[model samples]
Target: MMFGQTPVTHVGVDPFNPPNPDVWPATMAPVQQILREGLDLGPVTVFVGENGSGKSTLVEGIAMAYGVNSEGGSTGAMHHSRTTESDLHSGLKLTRNPGSSKYGYFLRAETMHGFFTYLADNPSMGRPDSDYHGMSHGESFLELILNRFRGGGLWILDEPESALSFSGCLSLLSVLTQLVDGGDSQVILSTHSPMLASLPGADIYEVGPWGLRPNVWEDLELVRNWRSFMDAPQRFLKYI
Candidate 1:
Protein backbone atom coordinates (compact mmCIF):
# COMPACT_ATOMS: atom_id res chain seq x y z
CA MET A 1 0.00 0.00 0.00
CA MET A 2 1.39 3.43 -0.92
CA PHE A 3 1.82 5.64 2.12
CA GLY A 4 1.54 9.25 0.98
CA GLN A 5 -1.20 11.08 -0.86
CA THR A 6 1.57 12.68 -2.93
CA PRO A 7 4.25 10.05 -3.09
CA VAL A 8 6.96 10.82 -5.60
CA THR A 9 6.10 8.94 -8.77
CA HIS A 10 9.39 9.43 -10.62
CA VAL A 11 12.81 11.00 -10.08
CA GLY A 12 15.80 11.27 -12.34
CA VAL A 13 18.46 13.54 -13.77
CA ASP A 14 16.96 16.21 -15.98
CA PRO A 15 17.63 14.99 -19.50
CA PHE A 16 17.47 18.15 -21.59
CA ASN A 17 20.50 19.90 -20.15
CA PRO A 18 22.37 17.72 -17.70
CA PRO A 19 25.44 18.75 -15.71
CA ASN A 20 28.74 18.13 -17.34
CA PRO A 21 30.15 14.77 -16.20
CA ASP A 22 33.53 16.32 -15.40
CA VAL A 23 31.99 18.96 -13.13
CA TRP A 24 29.72 16.52 -11.27
CA PRO A 25 30.91 15.02 -8.01
CA ALA A 26 32.39 11.56 -8.43
CA THR A 27 29.91 10.19 -5.88
CA MET A 28 26.96 11.25 -8.02
CA ALA A 29 28.18 9.68 -11.25
CA PRO A 30 26.41 6.38 -10.64
CA VAL A 31 23.04 8.01 -10.11
CA GLN A 32 23.60 10.49 -12.90
CA GLN A 33 24.26 7.66 -15.31
CA ILE A 34 21.45 5.50 -14.03
CA LEU A 35 18.94 8.32 -14.14
CA ARG A 36 19.22 8.40 -17.92
CA GLU A 37 16.47 5.78 -17.94
CA GLY A 38 14.52 7.54 -15.15
CA LEU A 39 13.86 6.04 -11.72
CA ASP A 40 10.45 5.27 -10.31
CA LEU A 41 9.73 5.75 -6.62
CA GLY A 42 7.30 4.21 -4.19
CA PRO A 43 5.71 5.36 -0.95
CA VAL A 44 8.88 4.57 0.96
CA THR A 45 12.07 4.53 -1.06
CA VAL A 46 15.37 3.75 0.63
CA PHE A 47 18.90 4.25 -0.62
CA VAL A 48 21.57 2.02 0.92
CA GLY A 49 25.27 1.62 0.37
CA GLU A 50 28.68 1.68 2.06
CA ASN A 51 30.23 5.02 3.02
CA GLY A 52 31.07 7.26 0.05
CA SER A 53 28.70 5.22 -2.13
CA GLY A 54 26.69 8.38 -2.90
CA LYS A 55 23.57 7.36 -0.98
CA SER A 56 23.66 10.62 0.97
CA THR A 57 24.48 12.56 -2.16
CA LEU A 58 21.51 11.09 -3.97
CA VAL A 59 19.13 11.68 -1.08
CA GLU A 60 20.43 15.21 -0.51
CA GLY A 61 19.94 16.00 -4.16
CA ILE A 62 16.38 14.75 -3.96
CA ALA A 63 15.72 16.83 -0.87
CA MET A 64 17.17 19.98 -2.46
CA ALA A 65 15.22 19.33 -5.64
CA TYR A 66 12.13 19.12 -3.48
CA GLY A 67 13.08 22.55 -1.98
CA VAL A 68 14.12 21.42 1.50
CA ASN A 69 17.26 22.73 3.18
CA SER A 70 20.41 21.06 1.95
CA GLU A 71 21.99 20.78 5.40
CA GLY A 72 18.82 19.73 7.21
CA GLY A 73 15.36 20.85 8.34
CA SER A 74 12.37 22.18 6.41
CA THR A 75 12.52 24.60 3.50
CA GLY A 76 11.92 27.49 5.86
CA ALA A 77 14.69 26.48 8.26
CA MET A 78 17.39 28.04 6.17
CA HIS A 79 20.87 28.59 7.62
CA HIS A 80 24.20 27.77 6.11
CA SER A 81 27.52 27.66 7.92
CA ARG A 82 29.49 26.66 4.89
CA THR A 83 28.13 25.55 1.57
CA THR A 84 29.27 22.07 0.58
CA GLU A 85 26.21 21.16 -1.43
CA SER A 86 26.71 19.59 -4.82
CA ASP A 87 25.01 20.81 -8.00
CA LEU A 88 23.17 17.53 -8.54
CA HIS A 89 19.84 19.03 -7.56
CA SER A 90 19.89 21.36 -10.51
CA GLY A 91 20.14 18.37 -12.81
CA LEU A 92 17.52 16.30 -11.01
CA LYS A 93 13.79 16.22 -11.49
CA LEU A 94 10.99 14.91 -9.30
CA THR A 95 7.40 14.03 -10.20
CA ARG A 96 4.96 13.68 -7.36
CA ASN A 97 1.38 12.47 -7.29
CA PRO A 98 -1.39 15.00 -7.94
CA GLY A 99 -1.70 16.39 -4.43
CA SER A 100 0.82 18.93 -3.14
CA SER A 101 3.06 18.09 -0.17
CA LYS A 102 1.48 19.26 3.09
CA TYR A 103 4.89 19.54 4.75
CA GLY A 104 8.50 18.38 4.44
CA TYR A 105 11.71 17.91 6.42
CA PHE A 106 15.26 16.79 5.69
CA LEU A 107 17.33 15.37 8.54
CA ARG A 108 20.99 14.50 8.23
CA ALA A 109 22.71 13.11 11.30
CA GLU A 110 25.94 15.00 10.67
CA THR A 111 24.19 18.36 10.45
CA MET A 112 21.57 18.15 13.21
CA HIS A 113 23.88 20.04 15.55
CA GLY A 114 24.02 22.97 13.16
CA PHE A 115 20.31 22.74 12.48
CA PHE A 116 19.52 22.85 16.18
CA THR A 117 21.84 25.79 16.57
CA TYR A 118 19.96 27.59 13.86
CA LEU A 119 16.71 26.91 15.64
CA ALA A 120 18.16 28.12 18.92
CA ASP A 121 19.23 31.37 17.29
CA ASN A 122 15.78 31.81 15.82
CA PRO A 123 13.78 31.35 19.02
CA SER A 124 10.57 31.98 17.16
CA MET A 125 10.99 28.65 15.44
CA GLY A 126 11.41 26.75 18.68
CA ARG A 127 9.03 23.97 19.52
CA PRO A 128 7.28 23.88 22.86
CA ASP A 129 9.45 20.98 23.97
CA SER A 130 12.61 22.32 22.43
CA ASP A 131 15.54 21.00 24.44
CA TYR A 132 17.19 18.96 21.76
CA HIS A 133 20.63 20.04 22.81
CA GLY A 134 20.20 18.61 26.30
CA MET A 135 19.00 15.25 25.09
CA SER A 136 21.11 12.41 23.78
CA HIS A 137 21.49 12.34 20.01
CA GLY A 138 19.20 9.37 19.69
CA GLU A 139 16.64 10.93 21.98
CA SER A 140 16.72 14.16 20.04
CA PHE A 141 16.27 12.31 16.76
CA LEU A 142 13.26 10.42 18.08
CA GLU A 143 11.88 13.63 19.48
CA LEU A 144 12.22 15.34 16.11
CA ILE A 145 10.44 12.53 14.35
CA LEU A 146 7.68 12.26 16.88
CA ASN A 147 7.09 15.99 17.22
CA ARG A 148 8.15 17.70 14.04
CA PHE A 149 6.98 15.01 11.69
CA ARG A 150 3.28 15.50 11.27
CA GLY A 151 1.71 12.89 9.04
CA GLY A 152 0.83 13.70 5.41
CA GLY A 153 4.33 15.03 4.68
CA LEU A 154 7.60 14.21 3.00
CA TRP A 155 10.58 13.26 5.20
CA ILE A 156 14.09 12.61 3.97
CA LEU A 157 16.56 11.23 6.48
CA ASP A 158 20.26 10.59 5.99
CA GLU A 159 22.10 8.04 8.16
CA PRO A 160 19.74 8.32 11.11
CA GLU A 161 21.29 5.19 12.63
CA SER A 162 24.44 7.16 13.43
CA ALA A 163 22.96 8.16 16.79
CA LEU A 164 20.53 5.31 17.39
CA SER A 165 21.03 2.20 19.48
CA PHE A 166 19.39 -1.06 18.47
CA SER A 167 16.40 -0.22 20.63
CA GLY A 168 16.32 3.29 19.21
CA CYS A 169 16.37 1.78 15.74
CA LEU A 170 13.39 -0.36 16.66
CA SER A 171 11.65 2.70 18.00
CA LEU A 172 12.28 4.54 14.77
CA LEU A 173 10.99 1.53 12.89
CA SER A 174 7.77 1.64 14.88
CA VAL A 175 7.39 5.37 14.31
CA LEU A 176 7.99 4.96 10.61
CA THR A 177 5.50 2.11 10.50
CA GLN A 178 2.90 4.36 12.09
CA LEU A 179 3.72 7.21 9.73
CA VAL A 180 3.44 5.05 6.63
CA ASP A 181 0.56 2.85 7.68
CA GLY A 182 -1.62 5.31 9.54
CA GLY A 183 -1.09 8.53 7.64
CA ASP A 184 -0.44 9.99 4.24
CA SER A 185 3.33 10.49 4.37
CA GLN A 186 6.21 9.52 2.12
CA VAL A 187 9.74 8.88 3.38
CA ILE A 188 13.03 8.49 1.59
CA LEU A 189 15.91 7.40 3.75
CA SER A 190 19.61 6.77 3.28
CA THR A 191 20.91 4.30 5.82
CA HIS A 192 23.38 1.51 6.47
CA SER A 193 21.36 -0.12 9.25
CA PRO A 194 19.95 -3.44 8.19
CA MET A 195 17.24 -3.03 10.78
CA LEU A 196 16.05 0.23 9.25
CA ALA A 197 16.43 -1.07 5.71
CA SER A 198 14.28 -4.05 6.67
CA LEU A 199 11.16 -1.86 7.02
CA PRO A 200 8.31 -3.99 5.80
CA GLY A 201 7.19 -3.11 2.23
CA ALA A 202 9.95 -0.46 1.73
CA ASP A 203 11.71 -0.42 -1.58
CA ILE A 204 15.45 -0.75 -0.96
CA TYR A 205 17.82 0.52 -3.60
CA GLU A 206 21.51 -0.24 -3.46
CA VAL A 207 23.66 2.65 -4.70
CA GLY A 208 27.14 1.67 -5.67
CA PRO A 209 29.80 2.04 -8.33
CA TRP A 210 27.61 0.03 -10.65
CA GLY A 211 24.62 2.28 -9.99
CA LEU A 212 21.24 1.90 -8.32
CA ARG A 213 19.59 -1.53 -8.18
CA PRO A 214 16.70 -2.97 -6.19
CA ASN A 215 17.90 -5.25 -3.42
CA VAL A 216 16.25 -7.62 -1.00
CA TRP A 217 16.96 -6.72 2.62
CA GLU A 218 18.47 -10.07 3.53
CA ASP A 219 20.59 -10.28 0.42
CA LEU A 220 22.20 -6.89 0.90
CA GLU A 221 25.92 -6.99 1.66
CA LEU A 222 25.47 -4.85 4.76
CA VAL A 223 22.84 -7.22 6.15
CA ARG A 224 24.89 -10.32 5.40
CA ASN A 225 28.00 -8.83 6.97
CA TRP A 226 26.12 -7.64 10.04
CA ARG A 227 24.53 -11.05 10.45
CA SER A 228 27.89 -12.75 10.09
CA PHE A 229 29.46 -10.46 12.66
CA MET A 230 26.65 -11.06 15.13
CA ASP A 231 26.88 -14.83 14.67
CA ALA A 232 30.58 -14.92 15.54
CA PRO A 233 32.15 -11.75 16.90
CA GLN A 234 35.28 -13.56 18.06
CA ARG A 235 35.93 -14.95 14.57
CA PHE A 236 35.77 -11.53 12.94
CA LEU A 237 37.68 -9.97 15.81
CA LYS A 238 40.69 -12.17 14.97
CA TYR A 239 41.12 -10.16 11.79
CA ILE A 240 41.25 -6.95 13.76
Candidate 2:
Protein backbone atom coordinates (compact mmCIF):
# COMPACT_ATOMS: atom_id res chain seq x y z
CA MET A 1 0.00 0.00 0.00
CA MET A 2 2.87 2.37 0.76
CA PHE A 3 4.24 2.03 -2.78
CA GLY A 4 8.03 1.88 -2.65
CA GLN A 5 9.26 5.21 -1.28
CA THR A 6 11.86 7.27 -3.15
CA PRO A 7 10.44 10.23 -5.07
CA VAL A 8 12.35 11.98 -7.84
CA THR A 9 13.88 15.31 -6.88
CA HIS A 10 16.97 16.78 -8.70
CA VAL A 11 17.89 15.60 -12.16
CA GLY A 12 20.86 16.27 -14.48
CA VAL A 13 20.27 18.48 -17.51
CA ASP A 14 22.04 21.15 -19.53
CA PRO A 15 18.72 22.96 -20.01
CA PHE A 16 19.06 24.66 -23.36
CA ASN A 17 22.69 23.74 -23.36
CA PRO A 18 24.10 25.06 -26.59
CA PRO A 19 23.60 22.57 -29.40
CA ASN A 20 26.69 21.37 -31.20
CA PRO A 21 27.14 22.40 -34.85
CA ASP A 22 27.01 18.78 -35.96
CA VAL A 23 23.41 18.61 -34.77
CA TRP A 24 22.27 21.81 -36.45
CA PRO A 25 19.84 24.24 -34.75
CA ALA A 26 23.02 25.76 -33.44
CA THR A 27 21.48 27.20 -30.28
CA MET A 28 18.22 25.78 -29.05
CA ALA A 29 16.94 27.16 -25.77
CA PRO A 30 17.94 25.21 -22.69
CA VAL A 31 15.67 24.39 -19.76
CA GLN A 32 18.07 26.23 -17.37
CA GLN A 33 16.23 24.81 -14.36
CA ILE A 34 14.28 21.80 -13.18
CA LEU A 35 10.66 22.40 -13.97
CA ARG A 36 9.49 20.26 -11.06
CA GLU A 37 11.49 22.25 -8.55
CA GLY A 38 9.89 22.12 -5.07
CA LEU A 39 6.82 20.46 -6.54
CA ASP A 40 5.75 17.15 -5.06
CA LEU A 41 2.76 15.03 -5.78
CA GLY A 42 0.84 11.93 -4.69
CA PRO A 43 1.33 9.81 -7.81
CA VAL A 44 0.71 11.28 -11.29
CA THR A 45 2.23 14.17 -13.28
CA VAL A 46 1.99 15.19 -16.92
CA PHE A 47 4.42 17.24 -19.00
CA VAL A 48 2.48 19.33 -21.49
CA GLY A 49 4.44 21.56 -23.82
CA GLU A 50 4.69 22.74 -27.40
CA ASN A 51 7.05 21.31 -30.00
CA GLY A 52 10.81 21.86 -29.53
CA SER A 53 10.31 22.74 -25.88
CA GLY A 54 12.83 20.59 -23.96
CA LYS A 55 10.26 18.17 -22.57
CA SER A 56 11.79 15.22 -24.34
CA THR A 57 15.29 16.19 -23.26
CA LEU A 58 14.28 16.52 -19.64
CA VAL A 59 12.44 13.21 -19.69
CA GLU A 60 15.39 11.43 -21.22
CA GLY A 61 17.66 12.88 -18.58
CA ILE A 62 15.30 11.75 -15.88
CA ALA A 63 15.13 8.30 -17.44
CA MET A 64 18.89 8.00 -17.32
CA ALA A 65 19.05 9.13 -13.73
CA TYR A 66 16.49 6.54 -12.65
CA GLY A 67 17.89 3.68 -14.75
CA VAL A 68 14.86 3.40 -17.08
CA ASN A 69 15.48 2.51 -20.68
CA SER A 70 14.94 5.33 -23.12
CA GLU A 71 13.68 2.71 -25.54
CA GLY A 72 11.25 1.12 -23.03
CA GLY A 73 10.95 -1.69 -20.52
CA SER A 74 13.65 -4.38 -20.59
CA THR A 75 15.25 -2.90 -23.70
CA GLY A 76 17.88 -0.41 -22.72
CA ALA A 77 19.02 0.28 -26.27
CA MET A 78 17.36 3.22 -27.98
CA HIS A 79 17.66 5.07 -31.27
CA HIS A 80 17.25 8.51 -29.78
CA SER A 81 17.04 11.65 -31.86
CA ARG A 82 20.34 13.27 -32.76
CA THR A 83 18.97 16.53 -31.41
CA THR A 84 18.78 14.89 -28.00
CA GLU A 85 22.52 14.43 -27.82
CA SER A 86 23.72 17.22 -30.07
CA ASP A 87 25.37 19.07 -27.23
CA LEU A 88 24.94 16.45 -24.56
CA HIS A 89 26.70 16.97 -21.26
CA SER A 90 26.65 14.50 -18.37
CA GLY A 91 26.89 17.07 -15.65
CA LEU A 92 23.12 17.34 -15.28
CA LYS A 93 22.15 16.04 -11.85
CA LEU A 94 18.98 14.14 -10.87
CA THR A 95 17.68 14.14 -7.28
CA ARG A 96 14.77 12.10 -5.97
CA ASN A 97 13.08 11.17 -2.73
CA PRO A 98 15.18 8.64 -0.89
CA GLY A 99 12.23 6.35 -0.19
CA SER A 100 10.97 6.29 -3.77
CA SER A 101 12.10 3.74 -6.30
CA LYS A 102 12.91 5.20 -9.73
CA TYR A 103 11.65 3.63 -12.96
CA GLY A 104 11.39 5.33 -16.34
CA TYR A 105 9.67 4.41 -19.60
CA PHE A 106 9.29 6.64 -22.69
CA LEU A 107 6.91 6.19 -25.63
CA ARG A 108 7.47 8.55 -28.55
CA ALA A 109 4.36 9.49 -30.51
CA GLU A 110 5.67 8.16 -33.80
CA THR A 111 6.36 4.64 -32.54
CA MET A 112 4.21 4.47 -29.46
CA HIS A 113 2.21 1.53 -30.73
CA GLY A 114 5.11 -0.27 -32.32
CA PHE A 115 7.16 0.01 -29.17
CA PHE A 116 4.36 -1.48 -27.17
CA THR A 117 3.96 -4.27 -29.65
CA TYR A 118 7.63 -5.14 -29.46
CA LEU A 119 7.54 -5.26 -25.70
CA ALA A 120 4.28 -7.10 -25.47
CA ASP A 121 5.63 -9.79 -27.79
CA ASN A 122 9.09 -10.05 -26.36
CA PRO A 123 9.59 -13.34 -24.55
CA SER A 124 11.68 -11.82 -21.80
CA MET A 125 9.22 -9.05 -21.08
CA GLY A 126 6.25 -9.80 -18.92
CA ARG A 127 3.68 -11.82 -20.79
CA PRO A 128 0.21 -10.50 -21.47
CA ASP A 129 -3.04 -12.27 -22.33
CA SER A 130 -3.81 -9.95 -25.21
CA ASP A 131 -1.88 -10.43 -28.42
CA TYR A 132 -0.25 -7.08 -29.10
CA HIS A 133 0.20 -7.65 -32.83
CA GLY A 134 -3.34 -8.75 -33.52
CA MET A 135 -4.95 -5.75 -31.88
CA SER A 136 -5.58 -2.48 -33.69
CA HIS A 137 -3.20 0.32 -32.80
CA GLY A 138 -5.74 1.83 -30.47
CA GLU A 139 -6.52 -1.44 -28.80
CA SER A 140 -2.84 -2.13 -28.33
CA PHE A 141 -2.51 1.23 -26.66
CA LEU A 142 -5.23 0.34 -24.24
CA GLU A 143 -3.58 -2.98 -23.61
CA LEU A 144 -0.46 -1.12 -22.52
CA ILE A 145 -2.48 0.73 -19.95
CA LEU A 146 -4.50 -2.25 -18.82
CA ASN A 147 -1.89 -4.99 -18.97
CA ARG A 148 1.60 -3.52 -18.89
CA PHE A 149 1.34 -0.48 -16.69
CA ARG A 150 1.45 -1.55 -13.05
CA GLY A 151 1.10 1.08 -10.37
CA GLY A 152 4.09 2.16 -8.22
CA GLY A 153 6.49 2.69 -11.15
CA LEU A 154 7.73 5.91 -12.71
CA TRP A 155 6.56 5.89 -16.32
CA ILE A 156 7.73 8.44 -18.88
CA LEU A 157 5.45 8.45 -21.89
CA ASP A 158 5.81 10.88 -24.83
CA GLU A 159 2.57 11.36 -26.74
CA PRO A 160 1.33 7.96 -25.73
CA GLU A 161 -2.19 8.44 -26.99
CA SER A 162 -1.40 9.38 -30.62
CA ALA A 163 -2.15 5.81 -31.62
CA LEU A 164 -5.41 5.79 -29.72
CA SER A 165 -8.66 6.87 -31.27
CA PHE A 166 -10.88 9.11 -29.16
CA SER A 167 -12.48 6.07 -27.57
CA GLY A 168 -9.11 4.53 -26.98
CA CYS A 169 -8.00 7.73 -25.32
CA LEU A 170 -10.98 7.45 -23.01
CA SER A 171 -9.97 3.92 -22.17
CA LEU A 172 -6.48 5.12 -21.30
CA LEU A 173 -7.92 7.86 -19.16
CA SER A 174 -9.91 5.29 -17.25
CA VAL A 175 -6.81 3.20 -16.66
CA LEU A 176 -4.81 6.23 -15.57
CA THR A 177 -7.49 7.15 -13.09
CA GLN A 178 -7.32 3.70 -11.58
CA LEU A 179 -3.54 3.92 -11.23
CA VAL A 180 -3.65 7.27 -9.48
CA ASP A 181 -6.48 6.18 -7.25
CA GLY A 182 -4.37 3.27 -6.18
CA GLY A 183 -1.61 5.72 -5.22
CA ASP A 184 1.09 3.32 -6.38
CA SER A 185 2.28 4.62 -9.77
CA GLN A 186 3.69 7.96 -10.90
CA VAL A 187 3.53 9.14 -14.49
CA ILE A 188 5.40 11.80 -16.46
CA LEU A 189 3.87 12.16 -19.86
CA SER A 190 4.25 14.48 -22.88
CA THR A 191 1.17 14.68 -24.99
CA HIS A 192 -0.88 17.03 -27.19
CA SER A 193 -4.12 15.17 -26.55
CA PRO A 194 -6.50 17.20 -24.43
CA MET A 195 -8.17 14.07 -23.11
CA LEU A 196 -4.87 12.87 -21.71
CA ALA A 197 -4.12 16.28 -20.20
CA SER A 198 -7.51 16.45 -18.54
CA LEU A 199 -6.63 13.81 -15.93
CA PRO A 200 -7.83 14.94 -12.52
CA GLY A 201 -5.09 15.71 -9.98
CA ALA A 202 -2.47 15.69 -12.75
CA ASP A 203 0.20 18.37 -12.68
CA ILE A 204 0.38 19.79 -16.17
CA TYR A 205 3.82 21.21 -16.96
CA GLU A 206 3.85 23.15 -20.19
CA VAL A 207 7.28 23.28 -21.75
CA GLY A 208 7.84 25.88 -24.43
CA PRO A 209 10.26 28.60 -25.58
CA TRP A 210 9.77 30.25 -22.20
CA GLY A 211 10.20 27.22 -19.90
CA LEU A 212 8.20 24.72 -17.93
CA ARG A 213 5.44 25.88 -15.59
CA PRO A 214 2.22 24.64 -14.03
CA ASN A 215 -0.62 24.95 -16.54
CA VAL A 216 -4.30 24.24 -16.92
CA TRP A 217 -5.84 22.47 -19.89
CA GLU A 218 -7.55 25.68 -20.96
CA ASP A 219 -4.21 27.45 -21.17
CA LEU A 220 -3.50 25.30 -24.21
CA GLU A 221 -4.81 27.65 -26.88
CA LEU A 222 -5.22 24.88 -29.43
CA VAL A 223 -7.78 23.03 -27.31
CA ARG A 224 -9.84 26.15 -26.60
CA ASN A 225 -9.67 27.29 -30.23
CA TRP A 226 -10.70 23.89 -31.53
CA ARG A 227 -13.58 23.64 -29.10
CA SER A 228 -14.74 27.14 -30.00
CA PHE A 229 -14.81 26.27 -33.69
CA MET A 230 -16.60 23.00 -33.01
CA ASP A 231 -19.36 24.80 -31.16
CA ALA A 232 -20.32 26.43 -34.44
CA PRO A 233 -18.45 24.78 -37.26
CA GLN A 234 -20.51 26.54 -39.91
CA ARG A 235 -19.14 29.93 -38.87
CA PHE A 236 -15.51 28.90 -39.37
CA LEU A 237 -16.35 26.92 -42.53
CA LYS A 238 -17.51 30.12 -44.25
CA TYR A 239 -13.90 31.38 -44.34
CA ILE A 240 -12.70 28.32 -46.17
Using lDDT, give the best candidate's number. Answer: 1
Which RMSD does model 1 reach against the true structure? 1.9
lDDT string for model 2 (153-209, tens) is 676676776788888888878776776566556667777788888887777877776
Error of 1 at 19 (Å): 1.3
What TM-score does prediction 2 earn? Answer: 0.74
Candidate 1 lDDT score relative to the true structure: 0.82
Off by over 4 Å in 2: 1-6, 12-27, 35-42, 74-91, 113-117, 125-130, 234-240
Question: TM-scores for all candidates?
Answer: 0.92, 0.74
Q: Give lDDT tens digits, candidate 1, residues 1-240.
A: 545475577887777757677675633656655466777877788889889988988888888988889988886767788899887888888887777564778999998888878877776535345788989999988887887777677889999999899999999988887777754778899999999998878899888888888889989988999999999999899998
Runs in model 1 deviating more than 4 A are: 1-4, 26-29, 124-129
The candidate that wins on TM-score is 1
Error of 2 at 106 (Å): 2.9
With candidate 2 superimposed using the best TM-score fit, by how many Å does residue 234's alpha carbon deviate from the native? 4.7
Residue 21, candidate 1: Cα error in Å is 1.9
